[model samples]
Structures are given as C-alpha cells and as structure tokens.
Target chain A: QQPVQSPQAVILREGEDAVINCSSSKALYSVHWYRQKHGEAPVFLMILLKGGEQKGHEKISASFNEKKQQSSLYLTASQLSYSGTYFCGTERGRQGGSEKLVFGKGTKLTVNP
Target chain B: DARVTQTPRHKVTEMGQEVTMRCQPILGHNTVFWYRQTMMQGLELLAYFRNRAPLDDSGMPKDRFSAEMPDATLATLKIQPSEPRDSAVYFCASGLRGNEQFFGPGTRLTVL
Candidate 1:
C-alpha cells in the first residue's frame, strides 16, 4: 500500500519554514524523498533507512521513526525555489530481497516571494 | 552530471493506438524503474528492472501494459490499445541501489 502524506498542501512565504509528514500502515524498510517543480521530474532529496543513520542536505533535514513507521521532512528558511510538490516513497521488504517503492499522493508546497 | 533520459517528451495518440516510451538510464546503474502519474491516483509504480531483469511488475496491467529493459542502459514501457483514461505522465528512474532513484524529465502522454 502507498504511504499517506499529511497537510495535502501548504503555502508559505519566503524565509518561512514547513514540515511535511509521511506515515505508512505497514512496516517500512525505508523512505525516500523527492521534490518536483512545476512541469519537471521529481528530484531526489534523501533517504532514511530502518536502523540506519538519518541524512540531510543543505537546509533540509529529515527524520524517520522506525517504531512509528513514519517520516518527516523539515524545510528551513524556505526559498521561492522550494515551491514544488514533495513526495515520500516507502519501500517494503520484498520476497526475493528486491526493493519496491510506493509513493504517496504528494504534499504540494508553495513558497511565495 | 549523469541523469536518466527519456525520449519523446510528449506523445499524443488516439484510442486503440499503441504507445511506447523509452528510457536511457544513467551509465553503470543496475536498476531501472517505471512510473505513471495521474491527477487522481498520483504516482504509481508500473515496473522496474535489476541488472536488466524485471524484478516486479505486479502494479502493471498484464493485458495491455508491458515493461522491458533491453540492456543495462535502456528500458521501455508499452501500452497497447490505450484509452483516454491512460493519458498521464510517465517517468523513468534509475538507481545503483534502492536507497535513492534519479528520475528523468518524464513523458507527457495524451490519448485523445
């Protein structure tokens, strides 16, 4: 099943901050995050693995709660360029050890100037 | 600055037609993934390949949709007898590991 993202959409001003959450009903092996601007492809941000280290890039920080089967993305000092849709893809344990990713509906974030 | 590339950024076809979308994965990447995006359903995984071998395609409709990876660098998704409902954006992604995937610009499909 696909993960669920909260706050379907959010609007923020430049320099503001926002947090997007993702939750899965089943146990997630890992969570992958991406950002996609209007008419563009989804760009990889980072990944959080179960029992693994959390990662960050630039001003973006993310955390994964293995116990809660949830992940949250934190965007600090949001810029106009941060206006886009954020997607969280949850990976499930496969039969043959292959990885399959299921993406959420996406959280559309709009940062205005 | 390696990135996945998809061909025919846009494709328009009528119902009962065949639509084939191609993808060229980043060099040395052993995994390729295909996805379809629609307004209602969001992003759906159609299929993926590991080492040119199909890993899973249960998300794809076996009857009309087929995905194949000809080699390490190439992948293809074909829809036969496509209907208007099939119109949406298709994305191809590649990755060396399941931890992250690099997506292509995507192919916007419109079935009239």
Candidate 2:
C-alpha cells in the first residue's frame, strides 16, 4: 500500500524551516526520500533504514521511527533551490526478497526568496 | 555521471495504438523498476526486474500492459491498444539491492 503524507502543500520563505511527514500502515524496513523538480526526474535525497537512523544532507535531514512506521523530512533554512515536490518511498519485508518501494502521494513545497 | 537512460522522452499517440518505452540501466545495477506518475496517483510502481528476471508486476494492468527485460542492461514496457487514461509520465529507475535508486528523466506519454 502507498504511504500517506501530511501537509499536502507548504510555502516557505528563505531561511525558514519546514517539516513533511510520511506515515505507512505496514511495517517498513527502510524509508527513502526524494525530491522532484518541475519537469525533471526525482533525485535521491537520503535513505533511513530501520533502528531509528537519522540522516542529514546539507540543510535537509530526516528521521525514521521504526516503531511507528513513520518518517519526517526537515528542511532547515530553506533555500530557493528547495522548491519542489517531495516523495517518501517505503519498503517492507526482509532482505533478499522482492523489495519494492511504495511511494506516498507527495508534498509540494515552494520557497520564495 | 552514471545514470539511467530512457529513450523517446516524449510520445504522442492516438487511442488504440501501441506504445513502447525503453530503458537502459546504469552499468552494474542489478534491479530495475518501472513507475507511472499522474496527477492523481502520484508515483505508482508498474513493474520491476532483478538481474534480468521479473520479480513483480502486480501493479500493472495485465490486460493491456506488459513488461520485459530481455538483457541485463535493457528493460521495456509496452501498452497495446492504449487508452487516454494511460497518458502519464513513465519513469525507469535502477539500483542495487537495498541501495538508492537512480531515476531516468521519464517518458511523457500523451494519448489522444
């Protein structure tokens, strides 16, 4: 099943902060975050595996709560380049099986100068 | 500069026509995934292959959609008698098991 994302859209100014949350009904073994610019392919941001690992990339960071099957992506001091649609893909099952990613509906974010 | 490559970035066809999209995964990538994106559905996984073998295709419309990987580096998705509803952006992503996936630019399909 597809994951659910909160705050369908958000608008922020430069130097602001925003949080996007993704929740899955099924247990997740890993959570992958991606950003898609307008008229472009989705770019890999970071991946958070089970065991509550938090990852940071530049001003963007994410936290995974394995127990709750939820993940949150944080954009701090947002820059103009941060404007895009964010998607979270959830993977379920153990290692070595048909591990496919089920993506969320996506959160549209706009950042102004 | 390793990346996934897809052919025919844009396609426009009439209903009941056949559409074929192709993908060439990055070197040494073992898994390839096909996805469809629409305004309403977001990103939906259509099919995926691991090591040139189909692993899952439950998300695809079996009646009109077919996916195949004839070689280690190539994957194809075909739609026969395509309908307007099939108009959407199709993406191909390749990765190793349990690794980050690299996505292609996508094929924008328009069926009129």
Candidate 3:
C-alpha cells in the first residue's frame, strides 16, 4: 500500500519553517524524500533508514520512527526556492531485497518571498 | 554528475497505437524503477528491477502494459492499444541500496 502524507498543501513565507509527515501501515525499512517543481521531475533529497537513523543535505533533514512506521521531513527557514511538491517513498525492507517503493500523494508547499 | 536518462521526453500518439518508453539508469546503479504520475493517483510504482530482473509489477496492468530490463544499462516500458486514460507522465528512476532515488525528466505521454 502507498504511504499517506499529511497536509495535502501548505503556504508559507520566506524564512518560515514547515514539516511534512509520512506514515505507512506496513513496517518500513527506509523512507525516501524528494521534491519536484512544476513541469519537472522529482529530485532526490535524503533517505532515512530504519533503526532511528537520520540523513540530511543543506537545511533539510529527516528522521524515521521504526516503531511508529512514520517519517518526518523538516525544512528549516524555508526559502523561496523551496516552493515545490514533496513526496515520501517507503521501502518494506533493506536493499537487494525489494526494488519496489510506495510513494505518498505528496505535499505541495508554496513559499512566497 | 550521473543521472537517469529517459528518451522521447514527450510522446503523442493515436489511440490503439503502440508506445514504448526507454530509460538508461545511472552507471553502476543496480536498481531501476518505473512510475506513472496522474492527477488523481499521483505517483504510482509501475515496476522495478533489481539486477535487471523484475521483482514486482502488480501496480501495472499486465494486459496492456509490460516492463522489461534488457540489460543492466537499459529498461523499457511499453503500452499496446494505448487509451486516453493512459496518458500521464512516466518517470524512470535509479537507486543504489534503495537509498536515494534519482529520477529522470519523465516522458509525458498524450494519447488521442
């Protein structure tokens, strides 16, 4: 089953902060986060492995809760460039086991300058 | 800066025609995924291959759609007797260790 993302859409001003959450029914080994702009493909952000692991790039970071089967992405001091749609993908188990990924409906964020 | 590459960025075909989309994954990436994006369904995983072997394709309609990886470097998704409802942006992605998925620009298919 596909993961569920909360807050289908949000609007924020530049320098603000926002959080996007993803939850899955099945146990997830890892959660992948990405962002995409209009008329463009989704861009890789970071991956949070199970076992309470965290990964980040720049001002974006994410954490995965294995027990809860949930993941949250934090965007601190959001910038105008951050205006885009964010998607979270869940993998059932470790790599080399399954190549399939279930993605959320995506959260659209609009940051105004 | 290696990236997944998809051919025919945009394809427009008549109904009942055959449509094929190709993907060239990043070098050394053993996993490749195919997804379809629509307004209602968002991004759906159509199929994926591990070591060029298809693992699961339950999300894809077996009758009209088929996905195959001919080699480590190439993968293809084909649709026969395409219909208007099949029109959507098809994206190809590649990843290592299922960690970070790198997506291509996507092929926007329009069936009329």
Task: Tell me, by lDDT, which candidate is best.
Answer: 2
For candidate 3, write residues A1-113 as lDDT tens digits: 88999889999999999999999999988898989999999998888887767665866888888999999899989999999999998889855477467889999999998
lDDT of 1 by residue, A5-92 (tens): 9989999999999999999999988898999988999988988888877554666789999999999999999999999999999987
Better of 1 and 2 by lDDT: 2
- Superior candidate under DockQ, 2 versus 3: 2
Query: What CAPRI grade goes to candidate 2?
Result: high
Q: State the number of backbone clashes in model 2.
A: 0
Could you give candidate 1's per-residue lDDT for residues B1-112 as a string of tens digits? 9989999899999999999999999999988999999989999999988889898899899999999987777899999989999999999999876557889999999999
Colliding pairs, model 2: none
What tens digits encode model 3's per-residue C-alpha lDDT throughout B1-112? 8988999999999999999999999999988999999999999999888889888898899999999999998999999989999999999999876467889999999999
Worst 10 residues of 2 chain B by lDDT: B93-102
- Rank order (by TM-score, best first): 1, 2, 3
Backbone clash pairs for candidate 3 read none
Ranking by DockQ: 2, 1, 3
Candidate 1 has a TM-score of 0.96
lDDT of 1 at B109: 96
Top DockQ: which candidate number?
2
DockQ values for all predictions?
0.85, 0.90, 0.81
- Model 2, residue A38: distance off in Å is 0.8
lDDT of 2 by residue, A1-113 (tens): 79999889999999999999999999999999999999999998988989766443665688899999999998999999999999999999756577889999899999999
